[model samples]
Target: MSLVVRPSPAIWVDGEPATALPIPDRGLDFGDGLFETLLVRQGQPVLLDYHLQRLQHGIEALAFPDCLPRARDHLASACKQLIGTPWAALRLTVTRGAGPRGYAPPERVVPRTIITSAPLQQDRDELSAPITLGWAEVAWSIQPRLAGIKHLNRLEQVLAANEARALGVDEVVMLDARGLVCSVSAANLFLVEDGRLLTPSLEYVGIAGTRRRLVIEQLAPALNIEVVQRDVHAAQLEQAAELFCCNAIRGLQPVSRLGEQHWQDHPVCSALHAGYREAVAC
Candidate 1:
């Protein structure tokens, strides 16, 4: 499929007016930036705090100047631009403005922040249905420091997504070097085994999902569900009765097929989806 190219919106670079970013921006050159894709519903940005907190955390990790206020201002402006628009997806990006031709970062960095909005997605509800999942041949490298953080460096996820598209699957479930389940190319994974909910720990792999946290916090207690974090291999997934993938944007998606492994209708995933919906509504 062709890459989706949405029109770029007005942006702010170091508290100034800009649209096209500079060529020497460290974000484009070295992927030294952080971004958050927020769900805008009813003209409100869903989980705004979570997205900003993550962005701030990522900026600190990269030792970039604090660009939260500027980013927030730009985001607010973009949301105002979409006043009559019912729904949309907003992308907020903060990059280390520009640097020399070297690995070392500049001393006084002026971060560039961009906020853009597009037509809202209709695929959010599709997660309630079953989805096809495939395994990526590209094993995810274990990076504890980078784990749980969303950064601009996502070549691994991009490649895995391509592999999934080639395999005709909705998503690709990636494994680490130790042959343990990590996550899908873009979302987190969960399996229902022996009446308990289990997911791979992000301590050594995968991104810490905002939706995942909500599921763990709200649904785990109300449903009396056990949420386990540990190593799970391909074999375990094959033997599992039900599976699902989730992200704040996508919500919860049931898994119907994983390569040749076919899963029958399972109530656990459906129940989880119902519970998650209630939580999000609340």
Candidate 2:
């Protein structure tokens, strides 16, 4: 794939406006980085702390130098430019800066932080609409060490998203190497069964989404809904009483159809979505 660089006014590198990253940058060359995509509401990044916490975990796991403070400051500066905008998408990326021509790390590392912002395209009505999901042909490889963090190595998600597009579904349910359901291409999956809410365990694969955590720890609990983390099989989708997917940007989206099975009028999902909107409202 040829790399196409487009100039954007919303890009910030090391707390300054810039259009391009240096050649040989580790993020570009080897995907040696971590990123967080946050929903910007009223010019502020929602769930900022959760995103940062995940990034910190990724940094520690990757043995990268501490750069969260710098990344945070850059993100704040970038967000300030979106003050009048009602909604936007913010991405904060941290990479082990340009290095010599090998996998060996430089004795001293200076991580690069890039912050970018774009207007959020999905409207409230669009986000509240029910969507369809298909099974992904691409299976997630089990990598426990990198399981829960949002690292830049997303080729698996990229492929799954392409498959979803081809299949004419809003998203695709990805399975781990063992054929256990993990998550959707870009969100966390939740299954409602027997009046209990269940989500796939991220111990072996998938990103531990901030929205997923919020739903499990706050929204569901507030409504007295039981939330369980376990190995959910693909077959369970057919039997689920209700199904939903969530991410920081889109909040909670109920699934209307998955293959031949169909769902309607998800009361639990509706309540949870209302709770999420209330929690994140500016």
Against the unseen true structure, what C-alpha lDDT does each candidate score? 0.79, 0.90
Instruction: Give candidate 2's TM-score.
Output: 0.95
Tens digit of per-residue lDDT, candidate 2, span 196-218: 99999999999999999999988
| Candidate 2 global Cα RMSD | 3.8
Residue 252 local lDDT, model 1? 83
Error of 2 at 275 (Å): 0.9
In model 2, where is the ten-residue run with the lowest total lDDT?
119-128
* Candidate 1 lDDT score at position 72: 87
Highest lDDT against the true fold, candidate: 2
Model 1 ranges off by over 4 Å = 1-19, 121-127, 279-282
lDDT of 1 by residue, 1-282 (tens): 768765455455544557677789989998988888877765567777877888877877788777788888877766676666556777788888788899788888888876666765464543466789999999888888788888888999999999999998899989998889999998888888988889998877778887777677776667898899888888989788788888877788889998789987868777767776655543
TM-score of 1: 0.89
